[model samples]
Target: MSETATAEAAYYEHTLTHRPLDPVSRYTPHPGLAQITSKLLTLPAEIRARIYHHAFQGNRVAVTSVRGCYCGSVATGPYRDDLNWMLKLPRWGELSYEVRRAFIGEALWEIHCEKAFEAFVARFRYLSNGNDALLRQVRHIKVNVFEIIRESWLVETNVFGPALRSITFGPWQKGWTIDVPNAVESPDELSDEKLMVRVTHAINTKHGYGFLKEAWEKGRVQRGGWKALFLFPIRYHVKQKDGKKRWQMQTWRADLDEGVIEKDWKDVHLVQEATLD
Candidate 1:
């Protein structure tokens, strides 16, 4: 089998082992909560799923370090009251598995720094007691680029699990900068897209590539574990368009193939555009 196929097969196998409970089994209520739980479960599977999505949809969670301790909090989107009530329901343990699966699967987890990333992983391992079931449910993440660059061990670590479908590198604060090898322009002066292009190139430079290659060769990273690598940085700012100021964020997806970073702007996408206050 091709490497991509092999990696995909591994992921498929992993998913099967941690598949979420079906609606019928999931709705089986705990002792005291039978009335409400049974009523909800009696609904069609599709309806139950819709309810789960509505409660957790668009949830953006941020993981950051404060006073040297790592913590997570809701960064955006409403924290639905229904979801809160569900958590406090009788024998929540009986329903927590499916609820957590939906919540983590749908939320976008954002990690702010390298240390916070480490803390997040460590906390997950500690809380889950090394089981990757919860990690596998995490489908989306928005993290600092430095986390990936410094923690290249993630390339081989099972910490992220096989279900991670999207990894966005940044929404770096304006004016943040990084040193790029062989770059003539100052990072501060470059536009966000251009700066990200340089940063991507840095990842492919001899030193950067060498570290990744060393890790793979040393068996620290699984061979063909990753299918493809792309970094999407979210940039927020104000721009003058049509003689009016507007809030906008530009994003670019750069693919890394065979240790080379492909800098293509054709994939640039504008997100969260709105009027600036």
Candidate 2:
């Protein structure tokens, strides 16, 4: 071969053997590191649930009636220290739904009074902007039912009815005693439907017109009627074994017994007329 051609062939062989690395491939993440950075959605559902539960444990939201109006605020750091850290998670929007479900579903909502409960509902509606997605996630609520005389219309509202799974009826006075028996003496013996009837009867006896049958009628006449009668299929039991008779009522979404409620409604009206007479 000619000297010039020989030199050119040698240059071509060197170029072919020592090609520069692609810039993108050079910066690619390690396979192990990519596996280590797996997303929350990639984890098993049970594991993700545990993570969400741990992240929001011990968090609380207090809704109090201040000057006859309601104000809702998150508990301070001592009570909800995890809140800040949870909010600071990377790519918040990606996990917003799961995070919110965990946060609201687990937190205890302390509503100081009936007024506070009403205000909380109003504020929740306003914040929701006509969407009940956030509200529906609520599972627990504590409210003072000692002076709830006007009727618990809000509890049966379409937006709040199915959302609340637990309702606690507590005394307004700090040290007052509620002399009420457990509606559920034996869970295995009594069906949910029977427990609901017992609890409804107890509440009606305790606070006449509080969970009134007339409220259902009025509600039906309003813009949007209630979904069920008396937050049906509820199981009631007392809490705080140390002599504080705070009744905690747990409800399930089941078919309501309209025939029973209608009969009770008639009975309530007759009693009211007799009292007036």
Candidate 3:
């Protein structure tokens, strides 16, 4: 776990709302809700685990990395209206509430991608009571990057860092493959990944997200023109060429703790992994 740039500062500004002294009073449990919770708790432990397992296992969710407080133009992309919105998780608060409610009902924490998890944590960090009760309940927030910029996701996870979880970067797209830049070659000196994963890892664990500014400044010279400066790190601007290239839709099942991420061909695949600088 590495410290954020803010950690270097003695203190923080733009403070978050603090929990009231009588924080217990904040939650007025509904009688109906309490009754239901009580009834569920009364069920056998094995039965309860099964119920939770059913809720999370293999559920397909649309993933989004919300770098901004609000989703703005890209408000979580597309989700199926079906499944009673079971796992679409369009809003950060909905997912956060879902996490807290599930944990309070029965200690189940379904894992999520790094971006989704950080989005949840970022949304609720200030009010976290002791034990990180909400965060602990988080297993993973499955991400479907949805043709988004690579830097967008990187900035998201860095906002929270290891204050979050394993991130399982890409069962969505081969964990972290989406963000790792294909343009650069790794010098012999440093060897995390030949691409952006290692750079992102360093910025996250060592220097903090601020490294993006420095990184972009260093590389902007190589970028083509003003348009590139406006979107310095977003590598995918125009869609692919060659009539053979077309979007290949993928289906997914949620893998539990195995943390499987598969490769989808992209810039990194253009060259052999062996020859990568």
Which numbered prediction scores highest in TM-score against the true structure? 1
User: What would the C-alpha RMSD of candidate 3 be, to one decimal place?
Assistant: 17.6
Against the reference, the lDDT scores of all candidates come to 0.47, 0.44, 0.31
Between candidates 1 and 2, name the one with more favorable TM-score. 1
Candidate 1 residues 1-277, lDDT tens each?
Answer: 8765564344323321111211222233355655666577567768877887887765556566543321321222122232344555554454555666777787766565556667667666665788766777777765543323433323323566767665544422222234333232343433545554565554555232343434334441353243334444333334355655443433344433343333443221211111101
Consecutive 10-residue window with the lowest summed lDDT within model 3? 268-277
**Shift in Å, residue 228, candidate 1:** 7.9
Candidate 1 residue 218 C-alpha distance from true site, Å = 18
Ten-residue region with minimum lDDT total, candidate 2: 268-277
How does model 1 score by TM-score?
0.48
TM-score of every model versus the real structure? 0.48, 0.45, 0.32
Q: How many residue pairs in model 3 have overlapping backbones?
A: 11
TM-score of the candidate numbered 2? 0.45
List where candidate 1 sits over 4 angstroms from the true fold. 1-38, 67-82, 91-93, 147-157, 171-173, 176-277
By descending TM-score, how would the candidates be arranged? 1, 2, 3
